[model samples]
Target: MSDNLQEDQQQAVLCDMCTEEDRKPARKTCMKCEISMCVHHLQAHVTTPVLLQTHPLTEPMASGAAGTTKCPQHGKLLEYYCLDDLTCVCVSCAIEDQHRLHNMKTFSTAHKELMEKLNAEQQALAKDENVSLEKWENGEREKLGSSSVRLIEAVSKLRDIALTSVQTSVSARMVSIKTSKSSMQVAQNEKDTFRFLQMFSQVHQDFEKAKAVDLRKGLEPGSDRDKLVQELRQGGEEMVAQAVQLWGSLLILVDPENHQEVFTTSSDLTFDPQSLGIGMSLSKDHRKVFYNSWLGQLSAHTLRIRSVHSTSNFQRWMVSLSEDCDWTIGLCDKESAENLKDGHVYGLRCQGNQLSSLTTDYYDFTDASRNLEDSSFGLQKVEIPKTEKKRRVSSQLIKCPGESGGDITPRPQKVEVFRNIAASSLSFFSRTGQHQRTEILTMKMSFDSSDFFAFVNLEKEQAQKSSNQPPGPQQQWMCSCGKVYIETGSGYSYGGCYYSKSPQAICSCGRVIGGRVIGDPCITEVVCELL
Candidate 1:
């Protein structure tokens, strides 16, 4: 039984570093160094200069079948890649870090996407090579071909000139040699060797003798190598320039050094909870804002996304909107969501198809529809949303058992009032599509990192019985105490509707619901809770 139990137990190798200090077990082996270390020594191996230089950190072989790869931070498996951050992260890191707000994809998916784009670039380069080469040949070939002909002619002429000079000098030298060596005893000189070899020997011997007598006096000075280099530089410049242009169009090279033209990942956008209204909660890295119940409590606050200002920051992001989304996405300053008018909408100020100010707002909001009337944000013919009933729970007093016990009854509930503040300049877009995924609006913002950005959202008359409000319509509300009542038609009337005297609703029980979303909603101080 003891032998069987021993056989059933698992075994492991001890860490080499730990064993050096004591008889400790090794957690994992460093593939680079072929040494094992305990968990403690594993960490030191990465931090200690001597150990780090000789060893690298890896997962313990005994841990599981997950392989010997672990995140440096949590010692967890790095299974996901953050597309927005461009990094590999553990499950914990993905849920807590800015990566939580970022776009994440599986490693396999990311690899596929990258390979696809790279393949696209390869295809583009192939096309460029064919088209550009053909066009360049057609345009410059006839002309350059003539130059080539001229070049060949010039080379041939130079070679001919050289051969002529060599021949004339050799003939002259031979004559001089005969005259100088006439006294030598070479009776059988005609039978010295083959005709060609004899001629070469005679010419060399004559040249040597002439040098001693200072026969040849002058030769031109030049460099064939230098001339070739100069010609190559002049002709290659144009071809190099065309290659650079084609590379820019087809290849997306990511590097900080190329920031002037490269598009890098933008920082994650999150909302400050302090900027959110009552009853709304932020979830999934502040990407979604949810109202707990259908019971509407009036609050004049717009949702905002955090702003990125650094020149290195350039990002384009899309927001998914449900078919029932009445919310708007926009850019604005801090005070925009704080200052609310009673009945006037506070978010965007949309006019026609064109937005109010491209300079002021990053963009103007518009819908993808054939007719303006069928859409909720038609500038002129604004149609109200259809009605839906919601259940409201009322608080009733409980009667304790007594001689004069009476049945408990509930009283009429007072309406709640919420107000929105006037922003310096607010911009927004209406939501559309199923799961809010289909009708995604992409916004591109490029700016210096030093500036502040505040994104805000406002759902117009959300709790109101009718959906007949304009793009950013607000409902009027008077407090139950009648102490605080905002002006009906005096909201920040920049791009929203500008009107007078509209119907007003009673405020619900005046309760000070905390301002802000549950998670980070973008606050310039901060910003992304959208209601």
Candidate 2:
């Protein structure tokens, strides 16, 4: 009874070669033979060289049945493994199935090789994980320390300014008050009647002055102290907001996958007329500028955009130029734009047949012409040949003919500029097709907390024609309240009337001027109270 209980508790696997009445527990299982054997019965596999080499032995399996070892599909013993498919296969499978051309190995060899490969991979991965973790930890600490130091320095500077201003104002007021008090006391101590009378007027005047002297007046609403305080408060708030924005941008920039989305959003920009140099004319939308001719020997004029962008923001824009035009387009900080010849700026300059990087500090037309092959500036000589193509103008596709056809040859070159402030990279790309672009050059530099603006300098000829040009002389209209609305040349007026579509003009005087469909001559007459 006790032996039977012990056997049941052990749940031992009996030797498949033993008789049923005298079955013995198995020590190992031979997968090749599909049988279990006790230690005594396993000696043949251990001593026999052929069986030792061929048979694959494993710890005793509960079911060493032939059915488990046979292939499910072919009903043959699974003898080979397919390395390509990573599966066990039978002889029939190896010869007939999809595993025919795959690299095959015996089951024992495949198992041994797979185990070794897995162990090696595990070790390599462990080492890589440790190294990456250390790097991340160190980088995180460094970033935090640097940011903290900058913030502390800014705060300390602000505090010092505020304290100095307050102390200076308070000290000046206290000195004035003390001087007045001493003068009044000396007059009050006069003993002689005659002297007292003579000093009476001066004493009374000094007393009145002292009484009117209000120390708090320095901190009054319109005083310098008050203004300084307000400025400091506002400045501190702005600094905090900027720090938060910069940190947020940095976090987003850390993920490499977000880079494309971060830098691809295009900015809708217009040229600032105030910044336009002589000889440049802008389109109705202030987007396109034409260089008819230079007014002086300094033919090159830099035009800036009206909108100012933070150095930490991402900005992208495209400039389309005529093939024969010599132009420079790029980004410049506010200070650099003022003095491009002596300041730091990043851009692409195209002169004659060469396209080179535009580093403003070393910018010179002669240098660019002489050093076209200079790799330091990433200069590339490109051919800008005249090509006949259809160009879109004012919502119309104008077909430009060849030189023989007596029509203008269209050769537009579109260059895209990308500014990534987080990475401090300004990249220029040439648009090759509708959906393809080739990188022209990339300028790497550190950016400070300054405003950046897009600028363009035309050296010689005019670039592409403006797409928003009016087909004819723009019609003008006037409201009853004397608001003159100029025609936009796109069948619309500045007064919010779509003359080409559903024509209507609602005056500021609450009067509806005209409501009619396009092509009606009366519609124009009705809306246009011409100035």
Candidate 3:
């Protein structure tokens, strides 16, 4: 009895592992279902382990609708497949109007066919994805290669632009340097002229002093005085000749790169006797006076000359024209109290190709002569005539020879001494057709021009007197109206645009006007007589 009870207990435990089914034999154990069952009762078992535990059935038919197909579109069991329309259909669907044209087949056959087609479509989609991925990778590589090349080209172009900028800058600097070189040459020439003029004046002064000493001593013929006189004469001539040469003009010299000369006039233009005439006439005041040959042509005009004893001899002259002749006169000399009443001196003039004289008072030779006479007399006879002095001005810095700092050569001081002398001398009375004995002199006149003094061969003598008197060392050169120094060359300075090696850039206006450094600046005279 105990053995029967143990066998019954083992049978009960084994029965606990049966599958659920309504009506079928559970002959096999379903490993995934976790069930064990007798084949004879398995057909009615429920499908899941939970259902099997509760119902305790043993049947293959327990899995409801096993091997049955479902329709995705209708959510219904696929009872049949329509071969003509290529669709699954239930028995009810086939009888309906929607499936009327569909040919029916078992659900098992339709399921197998649908599964094969779905697998083929998935495989095709995977292949297409791989091809698209390859194309995308190639495009990325091409884009990267193009970008690298563009970057390199951009860098090279930038480098070239930088180099071009540097070259342009260098060129501009070189041009500036060249311009500076040209201006320096002009300043140098002016300074040299100043130095020469100073030297010329000293030489003339020495000659005059020597002559004065000989005259005062009144030497005997056989004595050393006679020999000294001869020596002094020769020395004086030599010194005067040197002084005359100082008046010779200069030229503007150009560099070898530009071999051009600087001046326009080349005829050695000097005071020509052909252009002037002197004659004496008795004035209404019973004074013997002088008039220019040309002055007589101005409607029967007559000019008078008069002399006054001063430190230097003071001379006065005046012109009177017929009331019919509408000729105007101007003085070319500087204006001063003494010159104002003396006379209206005429400046050099040209009309209808005939050279004449202009009347102006700017170069009032009468005043200039008065000043020179007073200055020469050492303030004894006449208080030194107050003269208008030129203010000294300087040029920009230039590299001068033997200079420590850059040289600032001053523009030459203008002295109207020669003009004054001319005014006074010309005022001397002279008789018509009388052979006038005169001394030829070399006078230094300061002129404001690109050239220095005009080397004019002027006759110095008393216009009326032929009496033998020692010529005064301080003689005057004058005009009937006034005296004027010749102004030649353009007023602008050549080679004055340059600056020197200095920290400050000098302004262009700082340059001084000067004579030409390389050419003649005056007209030549064929014949001239001296007083």
* lDDT per residue as tens, model 2, 292-383: 22232225667786554444467677776644346677777776665555555667776654565655322122222332255678878644
Question: Candidate 1's residue-wise lDDT over 430-471, tens digit each?
Answer: 223111111112223332212334444444344552455234
Q: TM-score for candidate 2, please give it.
A: 0.40
lDDT of each: 0.43, 0.62, 0.35
A best-first ranking of the candidates according to their lDDT comes to 2, 1, 3
Worst 10 residues of 1 by lDDT: 410-419
**What order do you get sorting by TM-score, best first?**
2, 1, 3
Cα displacement (angstroms), candidate 3, residue 25, comes to 13
Worst 10 residues of 2 by lDDT: 522-531
* All candidates: TM-score: 0.22, 0.40, 0.20
Comparing 1 and 3 on TM-score, the stronger one: 1
The TM-score that candidate 3 achieves is 0.20
